[model samples]
Target: MPLSAARTALGSATAVALLLALVTAWASGTARRLKSGVLPIPAITFPPGPAAATSSATDFQEPYFPFLEGEVATASVSVGDTSHGFVVNAAQVTQDARLGILPTQLARGLDYGTEALVAMLEHAAAQLYGATKTRLWLGNVGQRGGGDIDFSVSHNSGRDADIAFCYTNWKGEPVDPPSLVPLNGQGQAPKHGLRLDAGRTWIVVKALLVYPRAQVQYLFIAGGLKTQLLAHARDQGESPALIQRAAATLRTPVGSASHNDHMHLRIHCGERDVLGGCTHTGAVHPWSKLYEGAKRLRTASVAATLSHGEAEQRRRALQRLVLLGGSEHRRPMAACLDDPASGVRTAAARAIAVLGGRDDIKPLSARFENEREVEVKIAIIQAIGTLGGAGAGRFLAEAVGQPDREADRLLRALDTVTILRGPALLSVLPDTAAALSRAIRTARLLDAAAGAEPHALDRLGALLADRLLDSDPIDPSRLVQLAAIEAASDSRRLELVPALVGLLQDRDPTVRAQVGRALRMITNFSYGVSWASASPGTRTKGLQRWRAAWRRSRGAPRDAWLITGFKAGGYQVPRLGQKQTWELVRAIAGADHFSVNAQAVLVRLLDHRPPSAQWSKNEACQYWLRWIRARRQRYDLDKPPVETSNACYRPAP
Candidate 1:
């Protein structure tokens, strides 16, 4: 055989051997689960727990872990955009494809991504279940410009894609003019237009697993329905290996409603895309390294040609380097500052803006003066803003204060400096208070730039609150204090609240409303009216009530909500190991924040399992609370410690 043919033959054999090994592994797991009396389907459908309420059937179940954090922290590929990544668009809008697109998603340019896996799955359904027998409907992928979508917490990134399950008629014929019709495990729809196509659905799941280039991170499905799919696969004589691999990807997600009718497929990030701030929370599959290696090689090839490549090649390389952010790549990117093509130069500036830090500020500022291209100049300013330190701040302050500066560029400089929040203003101007007052006077700049930095809020509140007291008539910067108070940490609030209560008497309705909201968030007190709609009378009463509470607490800072229910009414619980236990529980429950440590504790407490199979936060909380209370009470003052209390202890349902 020729070399190409021999390579293909080897690939095929490897795939087959891998499949068989997977089947044997899966079969062995199934036998263990069966002997142990673990069920194929969880009994309690509401929240996953061990030994579910009804079913005792056994099948291969994969270990579970949540996706990696970075959902909100990462910047979108586009400036002022929210989504963190980008997807290459696949299919055009086709009227005949049973796909439904949300109008809002379409309007925003979010309804696109790498559609290869989707295209393959669609093809597999048609081939396996007969032509025109099923239609794969799609929901939102990332929004256009890949930022935060209004309805999802994690879809701010491009890796996640929501596709509705395949629907068919009772006779296994495609629903005429295919549309999504959610069905239960009996393959029966709540309303009678269509039924679930189990075989076709299995084919879709199998295709995702076997698709050479596709690395599906998680396939969110309802637990009861997943049980049906696995059974269907087994009954259809699917090779044990293929079924096992497919089973590994399917899961019933916790912290959300059961994904009964649809599947949320989150693929891993592209190996080549350089995500500076983006993070992957899911388990890293071994195959992902292959994609990453290939992508790195491609990017390296492009970066290598930056000095000597064609204009288009250099521009492409510049864009790639921007996504693949690194200090090491900055030198080549800096060289692009002098590129003959204006577009390439602009791209180089933007890339450098993100990658360059304090050291690059001086060169960037010098370039800003001589660079004649308006776009490239703007890019340089942006780079300087991102490279923020005293030097960058001084440059920005000078630019904004320049008498000849254009209004728009000056405003842009003002906003950038506010975001950078270094000694920039102070280094050039008189003091910290003076710098903050200048930024706050810019009108709406304070609100626009607030909350990006937690510490910024602290400085704004402290400086501006004092400034407010000094001004006789009212200070315009008072709004800055109000906005800052809303975003301030509990520690900042401790220092600012006593002073802020006086603002309730301010004549400005906006200031009063903002202050009210901040007070409400910081404390549970709301004086018989919503601040958003509060009247002058309401504000007076609310302020009076807050004052009384402040005095009652003897001027101590109000407590954070996370500690409200603890024994001493603070986060610091008194008892042997109890403080740590409360923190662990809070972390596990993720009441207000995400913590890997908390998740790990929850996993261990739940017996080395990820939250699935009828596991709800309420159930987990109740179980832990009961265990804690029981252990706490286990010892009377005379009794010894409760040795019987294990981490996996559960209360009776």
Candidate 2:
């Protein structure tokens, strides 16, 4: 036989042998494909509990642990802008003919790490930006373990996922049992990581990293996670120069023998599955070294892991390092203006706004002019909408006047606008009018617009006036709209009278009759002013006054509605129109001239207002709001000790 022919025969036999082994290994396994799923970290035997109550548990479900019975496994992928969700049912996974699969990479199995990353990112985005940034895939790509030679079998049970960077050959396609061609001898799988454009991949990576739950794994760094560590070193712990140096090294062409394109991510698994000979006992790997290398490269390496505090602390620290002006990544705060990490950018924008400053204007405007992430851009627009004063207002008006004024940024700008009665509002009134004429019931947008311009009643005056005039009466749905409009009314000084006065003569019997209730909105405004404009310092004064009030008034917020005399909007607003309830509360509470009234009113707003009515001030509303805000404060304090009762409310470390 010719030498070439003999060599081909041997190679074919070898490939066949390996394929047969994979088949034999799982010939009786579940027929369905597994995708997205979450795995929680098991309680560890520590010095009682977490090193710090907030410290995240490093381990997850043990393989011996079982998953909930009959729970379906599914996954999906992000193919550009859309997130496609899929359930693990009869999926026609193409074995050959170029199946690009990014399967689970967890070594032990999908565990808290994997699940946490996704959730953390989502949480961060929502916390930072108020929306979820996670992409939905056919199902979540996953498996039981990591460090496995066969690329397709998702063996690791916890925190591991695999990706095919490139498609070289196919396996299970010609039939049920698929096979991957060996990249080389010695059972070294061929480099088949995902193939993606570079900068975009970084965006995805950033999004995952920002999630509080995520912990990323880099498969082929020369020094394990040296490269990874180096990148975040300056921000995470290393110095700037060291990080830059590491960045330079990563930019260097890493020898092709290693996979560089696609990443191997490990996630949390709901329970452990010990099917394969996979185990992560004492095998946990951290990206510590890689981060260090990058820090050394950037000359910014230091000692430490992220320390927990309250949300505010983390926010401020991240801001200083990522969002604020202090860190080298000054643009970090600005990235969400057009970021790919779903919600990171949004959260960044919101945080920047709350940490209010004149310094952010230029960067914010730049993002407005150049941003592309629809939601991120909108956030930027919204944050800067009312923040820019007259100059920002003019620019916003002009920018908003263009076609497609309701684009993401435009809509977001409309959402957070504060100067509703002024020139900026007047400029956008045309669009607002058009929105209302079409009966577009976007409660948030409408409420924001109304609140932004107190004279919303003036611009929308005709609509209210007409509704009042309708003899047939506006339906319940329309009443909801009216309520939202009324809620937005600032009722400043005297101008509010005409708008309400006009509604009094409305033709609609409902509008005419509801005038009394609507009149209460004016009083609601008084409550808002007395409460909304107060200072934190004035709280003490209010408390003092409250202490001096008749003891019976202690329960006033809960029962004040006894004073109302007629038809109700079904939506309960604690003191919607009880002017005396508001005024007397402020007086009795002896609140500071500037703030006690405000605190009194806030106490009234216990629960969130009804979706449409915008009249949310009440005890339940106030309590819940205070609770969330306090929890946020707890998050800022390195995950403070929750007095057991609040355990459920504590955020992830």
Q: Looking at candidate 2, what is the lDDT of residue 178?
A: 21
> For model 1, how does the per-residue alpha-carbon lDDT over 119-178 read when each residue is reduced to its tens digit?
544554445445444455566665422323445544533566666676666676855323
Every candidate's CA RMSD? 21.0, 26.1
User: What's the distance in Å from true for residue 314, model 1?
Assistant: 3.4
Which prediction has the highest lDDT against the true structure?
Answer: 1
lDDT of 2 by residue, 1-653 (tens): 33233222221112112211212222322122211110000000001111111223342211111112232233211100001000111112222222223233222222222333335433323332222232212112332211111232222222433332222223511121122122231212345421222222233344444344333433322233234434445545645654443443332223223433334443322111111111122123333222333333321211010132233322323322211112333344444345444234544554354333446767777765665444344345444532445444444443332322323222332211122222321221211222222111111121221222211222223343332222222232232234223222222112223344344333343343333233333222122212223454543354344234324343443224222211122222334333322222222222121122233343454332222122212322233333434544433422222332242233422
- In terms of lDDT, model 2 sits at 0.29
Model 1, backbone clash pairs (residues 3+ apart or across chains), number: 21
Which parts of model 2 have CA positions greater than 4 angstroms off? 1-331, 335-347, 386-392, 399-616, 620-653
